[model samples]
Target: MITEVAQIEVLPGHEDQFEQAVSQAVPLFLGAEGCEEVDLQRSTEQPGRYRLLVRWETIEHHTDLFRQSQGYQRWRALAGPHFAAPPQVEHLYSVLAP
Candidate 1:
């Protein structure tokens, strides 16, 4: 499986709204094809910073499928306004795990 990590920075004073938006958008990710898991993490040192982690069966499941689906549009619509800037996203594969 592959994990997509999106580093997002919310606009000042919009942190709570952004978090709520993410929560509301969870189903969009969960319902996508090949999506296995979704999670959101906040940076303790920077309240406005967040990391969105989504695990998929393959990289194409994210880049070629989900990103092209209507759910992706809905996701952006729900969470886009709160973004301070475009998120930095990357994908990773597990090398070793317990």
Candidate 2:
């Protein structure tokens, strides 16, 4: 499995709105193909900061499948304005080490 992690920083004073928008946006992720799970978290210390963790069957499922789908475009239109800036996203995978 592959994990996509994003550190989202909401604009000052827009935290509440951001959270509300995210609540609405969650369904989009949940409905996507190859999406195993989606988890959203907020920072206790940094009130306007959030972490979005999404698990996919493979990295291509996100970068190629989802990103190329119409749902992603619609999602972007809905959620784009809420961001303070473009989110910092990273692709990750588990490591089992000896």
**Where does candidate 2 stray beyond 4 Å?**
none
Q: For candidate 2, write residues 1-98 as lDDT tens digits.
A: 99999998888888887777777767888788999998889999988789989999999999999999887887777667778889999999989764
The prediction achieving the highest TM-score against the true structure is 1
In candidate 2, position 18 carries an lDDT of 78
TM-score of candidate 2 against the unseen true structure: 0.89
Off by over 4 Å in 1: none
Report how far off residue 61 is in candidate 2 (Å). 0.7
Question: What are the lDDT figures for the candidates, one per model?
Answer: 0.96, 0.86
Worst 10 residues of 1 by lDDT: 89-98
Predictions: Cα RMSD each: 1.0, 1.8
What lDDT tens digits, residue by residue, belong to model 1 across residues 1-98? Answer: 99999999999999889989999999999999999999999999999999999999999999999999999999999999999999999999989985
